[model samples]
Target: MTAADLALLDEEVTHCRACPRLVEWRERVAREKRAAFRDQTYWGRPVPGFGPADARILILGLAPAAHGANRTGRMFTGDRSGEVLYAALYRAGLATRPVSVSADDDLRLIGTRITAPVKCAPPANKPEPAERDNCAHWLRRELRDLAELKVVVTLGAFAWAAWWMALEPVYGVRPPTPRPRFGHGVVHQMPGLPAVLGSYHVSQQNTFTGRLTPAMLDDVFRQARSLAGEESRG
Candidate 1:
């Protein structure tokens, strides 16, 4: 990412108050848990996309976690959800490190990038449709900036739907027949710039209960890497 792009992202994230409900909830979380994260300033602001701007594979997560990305200002950082995600990314050979504690940490992605449909941590982790719509601009801008994007891996049903809807315009065509469904290892080749892949979100419930195991999630990334012209070790 260039300095200009980073600066623009920083400006957008810092001043993002598009959704009042998310703003209030994020502020409350920061206030309530001040001591535990006193040294870490909450990026309770909108979370920005992380990793290479020219990434060929973009992973779309549902939203930021209350104490995860919201607290750390980075996508998929500082929480149980990220723990599951980073582990799978590492196993898939897309990530150098298997941990994402904070944005300042030295973690890196090779051909993949991570982002969310809703940038801010929503109340109860559920965002209203209007709030999601408000945040779509950021998603659109991010996708536009990814000039070499060839694949997108949506981490849940909601994220899958959001990306599918957004890409229709970009591709200038109707979605493919039997639209992609959400599963552990579902893949969709759309008539677009990038093929869309689906995977169950690596949330706490899915990870802890074995609904979405690390190996299963890693398989999705393996598919993504393959589509992006990278070899998959799995």
Candidate 2:
């Protein structure tokens, strides 16, 4: 896939209004400003995935947080989860900074790209089955565009499922039966596709409960880097 194709897709994604439910909810949240970010203008539109077109590692998240990415217009920004996720990424040598505050934060990733299955923020942090299926088109297109990707780190079960499902259409292969389960540090290798590594989402629920710790995230990202390094050499 070429950079032009990814750029074109990014442009198209931002203007998408295919899912009415997502469209309504995202706009509603933007209109009713959060107390902490009352003075800031919210971006009530689909958030495009960001990173270099040739990145070898793809980080998948579930969806935008109502007051986080939906507010900052960048995935995993302006929120508690980003604080945890970026800190671990920095420690693993993937990110240049330990925090992601805004879309223009100048935080860079090495050999990695980040995206979400659902582009818009959903009410109550849950997207229905139809919304996911509709959004899968954008994700599959992205997977095809990231021609050099060799590893995928799914932030939760939803992301794990989305990544695996995308591979079938993006790479033209039927998945193995009894789909791989999600778990912290679980790795699944599929031929002609990026190896998928599962991690509990960097959400507050997981991080606060100690279900996903800094060490846990580091272990996953470290292995992801190693795998990407090997692919680059190959």
Best by the TM-score measure: 2
Candidate 1: worst-modelled 10 consecutive residues by lDDT: 1-10
- Model 2 residue 116 CA deviation (Å) reads 0.7
Model 1, 1-234: lDDT tens digits are 453684487468667898888989988887776577777667667788887876889999988888888899888899988988888888888889999898889999877888888898988889999999998878877777777888999888999888877875555667656766676677777544688888888888888999988778877877888898877434
lDDT of 2 by residue, 47-69 (tens): 98978799999999999999999
After the best TM-score superposition of candidate 1, give how far the Cα of residue 82 lies from its true spot, in angstroms. 0.7
Total clashing pairs for each candidate: 0, 0
After superposition, candidate 2 runs with Cα above 4 Å error: 230-234
Residue 197 miss distance in model 1 (angstroms):
0.9
Q: Return the top candidate by lDDT.
A: 2
Q: Rate the local accuracy (lDDT) of all candidates.
A: 0.82, 0.90
Per-prediction RMSD in angstroms?
2.4, 1.7
TM-scores for all predictions:
0.91, 0.96
Question: What's model 2's lDDT at 54?
Answer: 93
Candidate 2 TM-score over all chains jointly = 0.96
